[model samples]
Target chain A: MLSLLRPGSNPRRELEAAAIALLLSIAIGSLLMLAAGVSPGRVWFAMIERTAGDPYLLGQVLYKATGLALCGLAVALALDAGLFNIGVEGQLSAGVLACAVTGASLPESTPGILAIPLCLAAAAAAGAVVGASIGALRAMRGAHEVITSIMLNAIVAGVSLWIGNEVLFQGGTTRGNTIVEGAQLPLLPMSGSSVNAALVLALVVVAIVWFLRVRTTWGRTWIAVGQEPAAARAVGISVARVQTLVMAGSGALAGLAAANFVMGHKHAFEEGLGRGTGFLGISVALLGRSHPVGVLLAAVLLGLLSSGGLAVGDLVPKELMEMLQGVVVLSVAAAGPWVARRSVTVVPEVAA
Target chain B: MTTARLMRVASLALAACVLLCAGALFYGGSAYALERWITGGVALAVVGVACVVAGAFGSTAMRIAAVIVAAAAIAGAVLETATHSELFVAVASTAFGAQALKIAIPYALAAMGGAVTERAGVIDLALEAKLLFGAFTAAAVGYASGNVYVGVAGGVLAGMAVAALQLGLALRLTADQVIVGVALNLLALGGTRFLLQLIFHEGANSPPSPAFENTVLSNPIFWLAVAAAVLVPLAMLHTRWGLRLRAAGDRPEALVAVGASPSRARFAAGLVGGALAGAGGAQLSLSVGGFSADMSSGRGYIALAMVILSGWRPAWAAIACLGVGGAEALEIQLQVTGSGVPRELAPLLPYVLTLIVIIIAGGKGSAAPRSLGRVS
Candidate 1:
C-alpha cells in the first residue's frame, strides 16, 4: 500500500499501465455482457461490421463526424481560454432555431444564393448573443463561467422549447416549420445522404481558427491569459476583451454546427435536435487534447461509435455502444494525469 | 460601501426578479401565475438571505437562516392552503411545500456527501454518476430480491464501489482527482445503463417494487432521513474522526506532519459521501415507487450548488435542499392547477432563482470551504 504512494513512475510504464487499464475495462464490459446472457464477441463484431458494412452507413458516420468536429473545435477554443462553456448546448439550440426561423421565413421567390448566407448569419448571430451574455457576466461581475453557462443552458433550453412548441412550431404538427426550397442547403449528387456544402464550411472555419490561434498576436494574448492571467494582465492584455472574443467565436462555431444539422439535413428546427452533442463536444476536446487535427480524428471516432451503435441495434443493444463510449472517455481522462506526470520530467523547471 | 452602489445593486437585483416574475406571469397567465411568482421570487429571496446571513453572522448563522427559510416556506405553503385564497394557496402549496422537498432531499443528500468529501480534501464532481449508480443498483436489487432494504443496501454498496475506484486513482496513483471523479461518473452512468438494458431489457427506468413505500409522515424512512440531517452536523462538530477529517482538508501537510495519513481521511470521507448519496438514490427510487432515466435529472449538480450555498454545513444543506425541493414541488402543483402560468416557466422557476441568488451573492468571498477541490 505504501509503495502505491510513491511518485516518479517512468513514462513507458505509465503508458503500459494505461493500456492494461483499457484492456481490463473491456474485459469487465464483456463479463457484464456475459452475465446478462449475451455473447460479447458477437456484440463487438456487430459494432465493427455495422460501421463499415455499407457505403450508406459510412456516409452517415462521416456526416455525424462533421458536426462533432465543429462542436469539438468550439469546445477546444473555449476550454483553452480557461472557460468552461457548458452553455454550448444552449448556443447550438438557439443557432438551430435561428437558422430554421430564417430559412423558413425566406420567400420562395428569394434568390437561393442570398438566402444561404442569410440563414448562416442568423444562426451565428443568435449563438453570439447567447455566448456574449455568459462572457459579459464573467468579465464584468466575475461570475464563475461554469455556473453561469449552465444556467444559461437551462434558459436557452426553455426559450428553444418555447420557440419550437409555440412560436416557430408548425401548426397542427409537433415539428417546426420547414424551410423554403430556396433556403435549403444544396446536397452533393449521388450521395443519397443529405451531406451538404456545410461540411466544407466547417472545414474552412477549422482552418481559420487554427491559423488565428497559431499565427495572430490576439491568439498569443489569449493563450497568455489562459496560461497565466495575472502575468497577462500585468503585460497590458485586456483579459475581458480576449474572453469576450473567445466566447463569441466559440458560440459562432457551435451555431454553425447547428445550422449544418438543420438547414443541411433536417430542413427544420426540432426539439432535442442538439441532443447531448454540446456536452459530447467536451469529451471530444479532451480526447483530442485541444488540437484541431486531433479534434477531427476524435470526432470521427465518436461518430463511428454513434452511427455503428445505431446500425447494430438489432445485434447489440445501443446501451452497449453508450457503455463503450463512456469507457473510452473514462480511460482517456484517467490516462491524462499519468501522461502529464511522465512529461513533467522533461520540463522539470516549469511548474504545470 | 457607498449607499449609491448598494442601492444600484439592490435595484438591479429587484429588477431582474421583477422581469423574471413578469415573464413567467405573462407566459403562464393567471392559471398558475401566483405559483410561478412565488416559486421564482421566494426561492431567490431564500438564497439572497442565506448569503447575507452567511456574510454578516458567519456560516453558523447561514445554517440557521437556511433551516428557517425552509421551515417558513413549508409553513407558508400550509397556511396558503388553509386560507382558501387562490393566489396565496397556489403560490404556497405549489411553490414551497411538498414539491420543494422532493427536489431538495436528493440535492441535500448529495451536497452533504460533497461537503464531507471536500472537507476531507478529496474533489468529487462525480455526484451525478454516484446518483445513477445508486438508483440503478437499488432498482436492480429490489427487483431481484423483492426487498427495498436489500435494494438500498445494494445502492450503498454500488456507491462504495465508485468511492473505492476514485480512491485508488486519487490516493494510490495520485491522479488528477477531478478528472478521475468525472471519469468514474461517466463509467458508472454507462455501466449502469448497459446493465439495466441487458438485465431488464429496458432502459434505465425500473418498474415499481412492492416492498418500497413512500416516506410520508407515518413512514420510518422519513424519520430516518430527518435523523441523518440532524446527526451529520453533530457528528461533524463533536467526533474525533470528524476533527481529523477537517484537519486533513484544511491542512493535509499539517496532518501528515502529525503522523496522520491525509489519504486515509480522504478515503473515509469519500466512503461516507458515497453512503449519503446512495441513501438519496434509494429514497428517490424506493419512495417514488418507480424510476425513469430523467428521474435524477440534474439533482446531483443542484446538490453540489447547495453545498456551496450552504457553506458546507450538513444541516444547512438539508434545509436549502428542502427549499429548492419545495419550490419544484410547488411548480408541479401550480402546473396541475392549470393556472395561467406557462408550464415551462413553472418548471424553470427553481433554476432561475438559483441563478439570481448566485448573481446577488456576487463572486467575492464565497462561503465554500478553503480546502474544497484541493488535495495534498
Candidate 2:
C-alpha cells in the first residue's frame, strides 16, 4: 500500500492520470452496481439528495471533510519530499490521544484561548514525536519508513488502547472523560449542525500549505530533495534534514486532524476515534493530485461518499459504497499512469 | 558512518533499558516494568553478551555456542517470569506447544505467502485482505455446504481472487503496485463486512460452520503450511520456474534476455502464494467455526513484517512466525496463571517483540532483492 505511484514526471501528467482514473472507477463502479442488482442511478441520486437535504447532514459531511483535508495534506506533504509516510494512522491517533487527555485534564476554568491552544499543541507535539522517530530511523539507521511505520502503528494502537482502558476510561463504557467546556470548539451558525470552527481551521491549513509550497524556500528545498536527492546534496542541501523535517511536518498535519474529532465534535477520547481517516486521506491526496485546493475538494467529495453511504444503506449494502471508493482508488492508481503513458513520450527507466 | 552509529546507539539504549529493568526488579519489581520491559530487556542483554563472547573467542563454534547459550537464557528467563514455581512444568506441557503451533499455522502460511509475491517483485500488502477474504469464504462456505474441505478450497479461491486483482492491476494495467494492494485491502475489509450482512443477515458473524477440530494435527491446512515451509524455498532456488520468478524480482532484464515473461512468472507465484495465505485464512475461520468482521485482525501485517525479517525467504519467514505465535501463547499462559501484568496491555507483547527484534536484527540493505518494488 505504501509504494503506489511514484510521483509522475510532471504536474500536467499527474492531472491527466487522476482524471483518467476517475473515469475508469466510475465505469467499473457502474458495472459493479449492475452486477449487485442495484440501480446505479437511484443509489447516486439518493446519496446526493439525502446528504444535501438536511443541514445537519450537510454539516456532518463538512465535519468529516475537516479531518480529511488535514490528513490529505499530511500525506501530500510527505509525497512532496518523495517519502511515503504511511504512519499517518498512528500519528493521527497519537494526536487524538494527547489532545483528548490534555483537553479533559485541563482546569475547568481555563479560557478557550489558553485550553484550546494547549490541547492543539499537545496533539501536534505527540504526533511530531512519532513522526520524528520514523525520520530519525531513516536518517540514522537507514530503516525504511514503511517498516518503522508498521511497527509504530502497532505500538501506538496498543499504547492508546491501554491508556484508554486503564486511565481515561469511564465506568461501564469505552470512552474517556470529556473535555473541559472551555476547550470545546464552537459550532458553526448552521442550525443544529455539528459543523464547527474546525472547518475554518482546515481551510486555513490548506491555505497555509499552499503558501508554504508556493512562497517559501523551505518548500522548494524539500521538492528539490524529493525529485533528485543526489543533485540536491551536491548543491549543499542536507537531504536527511529535509526528509526528517518533512516527516515531522507531515506528522503535525496529521495530528491537527484531532481538531475535528476531539475538540470540535467528540469532545472526548473515544476508542477507534478517527479510525480510518488516515488511510482515507491517501485516497483524498491521490484524487486531489496532491494539490491543496484539489485536496480540499477531494475531501468534501469523499465526505459526501462517506455520509451518503449511510444515507443509502436501505437501498444498497453500505459496504458496497466503501468497495466502490476502493475501486476508485485502485482504478486511478492503475489507469491514471497507463493513460498518462499513452499520451506522453516514454521516459527511460532510471537505474535501480 | 550512520549505520554504525545507529547500531551503537541502539545497542546502548537497549543495554540501558536492561539495566533499568534489573534495577526495578530488585528494588520495587513493579508489574508495569515486568510487563513492558523484561522480555526485551533480557533478550537484548543476552544478545549483547553473546556478541561480546563471540568477538572475543573468535571461532565459529564458539559463536554458535554463545548464541545457543543466549537462546537458553532468554527461554529460561521468560519461563521463570511467566510462572514462578512448579507451574513452569505445566506451562511447558504438550498442550502449550500445541497452542503455539496452532496459532503459528496461519501466521507462518501468511508470511510464506508474503515471500512468494514479494520475492517476485510484487508487494503483498493485500495479504491482510486475502486473509480476511479467505477466512470469510471458508466459514461461509463451510457453514452453507457442511463440507470442511470444500470450505478450505473456497477460501483458497478467495485468496487467489484478491491476488488476481492485485497482480492484474499492478502488472497488466501498470498501476502503482502499492496503491493497488492498498485498494484491495480496503475492498476486502469493507466488502467482507457488507457481504456478512447481506448473506448472513447478521453483522456480528456468520453461523457456526462444519469445521475441522481445533487441533493443528487434524487440520490439513497445517500440513500445507509445513509443506510450503520445506518446499517453497527449494523450489525458488532449484526449479526453472522459480529461477525465472526470481529473475523477475531481482533482474527482469535477464528474463527479457531469456524471452520468458516476468509478469507471467509473477502471476504464477502470486497465485501459489495466494493459495497458501488463503489456506491460512481458512484455518482461522474453520478453527473458530465462524467468520467475524475484521477477524483476520492484523495477522496479515505481522506476516508482512515476518517477510522482511526473514529476508524474504519463505521457510525462514515461517520459522519467525513461530516466535510470534509463541509470544501470543506465552501471554495467554501468563494470563491464565494469574500473572499481575495489566490485561489491557497484553496484546502489545507480540508487536513489541517484533519491533525490538526488527531493530536489532533487520534493516539490512543487502537482504532485499535489488529490483524489488520496481516496474519492468
Candidate 3:
C-alpha cells in the first residue's frame, strides 16, 4: 500500500496519487460545505443516492460524461504532442456552430443516419480548422499556444454571440431553431431519459483513441516529440507537423464532444450549450492522467459530481462541487510531485 | 543597412496607404462626400509611406518626417470624426477616457503582478483566481465592516493567500504552473460562487458594499492603484532584492554561486506580485461596489497579453493596459451609440487586437524573461 502511494513511473503509483488527491479534495469540499451550514455528510449521501438511485439522473450523468470524456481525450491528445490546447472551449464553440449550421441547412427528408453523421463530421472539421490555426500560429509565428488559445476562446465567444444573434437566432429568442428531426441523434431505450447514441459513440471514440495512442507510428512519434522535441527533430521527425496534426485531432475530439449537446441533448444550438464543458475537460484530463480508461472514468466521476451538486442545491450550493473538482486537480498535481520526491529520497536511503 | 529590407517595409507601408485611400474613396460617397479631412488623411498617409521609404536610407530627418506624417494622418482621421459628430468628441474625451481609466486599473495591476512573477522565472496564470478571490474577500469584508479600506486589506490578504498556494504548488512541488494556475482559477470561481450564494442566498452578485464615490481625488483605491503602477516598476528595477529576483529568473545558478537563494527570491517576488494583483482586485470590487460572479471576466487574461505586449516591462505593461482599456471603452461606446459596426463584432476588438499584436510581436527577439516559466 505504501509502495502504491509512492510516486513513480509505474501506473499503480499514479493511481494511488490520484486517489489520495481525490480524498484530500473531498475533505476540503466537506469543510467548505460545513462552513456553508450544510451537513457535508447529508449532502454527499444525497448526491450519491440521487445519482445512483434515479434512472433519469443516471442518464443525465452519462450524458454529461459523454461530452466530458471526448473533451478530456481532446486535451489529452494535445498534451501527448507537448501542446497545451486550452482552446478546446473555442473549438467546442466552433463545433456547435458547425453542427447547428449544418443541421439547419440539411433537408428534412434526409435520413437520420446520413444527416447525423454529416453534422458530426462538420463539427469535427470546423473544430479541426480552429485548432489548426492555433497550431500554425505556434509553429509558424512562434506565438505561445496557451495565450493564443485563451484569446481564441474570447473571440469565439464573441463570434458565437454574433452567430446566435444575427445568423441562427430564432425570432425573438436567444436560441437557434431546432435542427431537422433527421439531424437529432436517436435517444436510447433508457426510460424517461435523454440518453442517446452519443454515449456509445463516445465509448467507440475512446476505444479508437486508445488504439491509436498505443499502437500507431504517428502515436509513437507524437509521444517522442512531446518528450524531447529536439531529440525527435534530431531523429528527423517534423515536430511542427506533429504539433499541428495532433492539435487538430485534439480539436476534432472536442468538436465531436459537442455532438453530445447539439445533437443528443439540445437538438439545437444555443448561446451557452457547451458552457464550461471545455474547461471541465481540462480537469477531467488531469484527474484521469490522460489515459483513455482513466479519462473515461474521470469523466463519469465528474459527471456524477455535477449531477450531485445540482441535486443538493437546497442544502449546499452546487458551485461547491466545481470547487472540489478544481481542488482535486490542483491537489493531484501537487501530490504527484511531492510523492515522487519522497519516493526518490526513500529509495536512495534504502539502497544506502 | 540593407536597401532590400527598407524597400520591403516601404512597399508594405505603401500598400497599406493605397488600400486605406481606396477604401476611403469607395466609402466616401455617402458620409464623406467632398470631405477634405478624409482626403487629407489619405494624403497624409501617403506622405507617411513616402517618408518611410526615404527613412530606409538611414536619415534621422526622414524618420522624424515619417512620424510627423503618421501623426498628421491620425489627426486627420480624428478631425474628420470630430467634425462629423459632436457627441463622438464629447464621449471620446470625457466618458470614454474615464471608462478607460477604470478598465485600465485592474489590467495594469495584474500585468504588474505578472511582470514581477515572470521576472522571477514563475508564470503565475492564477492572476484571474487572485483577482476573483480578492474581489470576493473585499466585497464580503466591506459589506461587513462598512469600511472600504478594511475590505481592501482583506482582499489583498486573500490574494496573497491564493498566491502562496501557487508558490507552494508550482515552486515547492514543481507542478506545471499552467495547470496549477488553471486549477486555482476554477477553484476561485467555484469557491466564490459557492460562498456568495451560501452567505447572501444569491448566486449572481454580492450585496452592495461600501464603495468609493466617483470623486476622482477622494477615491483612495484609484490613487493607490496608480501608486502601485509607478512604485512597482521602481522597486523592480532599483532594489537589490529586485536584482536578485531578476537573476533568479535569468541566471539562477549565478545567484546560487554567489551564496544567495534563488528560490527565496522567487518566493518573495511571487508574494509581492500577488499583493499588487490583490490591490488591483480591490480596485475592481471597490469601484463597482460589490463582487459579481465571474466579474474578473477575462481581464486577467487580457493583462497577460498586455504583459507580453509590453515585453516584460512594468511601466510599459501599465501603458499597454490603458490601450487595451481604450478598446474596452470603445466596445462599451459602440454598444451605447448603436454604431454602424456590428455590436457583436465591437466587443471582439480587444481580443482580436491582442491576437494580432501577439502574432506580429511575439516572435524571435521579443523581450520575454530568459527563463520565464522554467522549472528551477
TM-scores of chain B alone in all candidate structures, in the order given: 0.80, 0.87, 0.80
Report the Cα lDDT for candidate 2: 0.79
In the range A43-79, model 1's lDDT, one tens digit per residue, is: 7687777667677777777778778888888877876
Docking class of 2: medium
Query: What is candidate 1's lDDT per residue for B209-243, written digit by digit as tens?
Result: 53444335544445656877888778778887787
How good is chain A of candidate 3, measured by TM-score?
0.93
Ranking by lDDT: 2, 3, 1
Model 3, which residues run further than 4 Å from truth? Answer: A1-9, A345-352, B1-83, B91-95, B215-217, B363-366
* Local accuracy of candidate 3 as per-residue lDDT tens digits, A39-138: 8899889889877888888888888889899998898888777777789999999999999889988987989889989999999998998898788667
Query: Interface RMSD of the predictions, in order shown?
Result: 7.0, 3.5, 7.0
Q: Between which residue pairs do clashes occur in model 2?
A: none
Using TM-score as the measure, the top candidate is 2
Order candidates by TM-score, high to low. Answer: 2, 3, 1
Best of the candidates, lDDT: 2
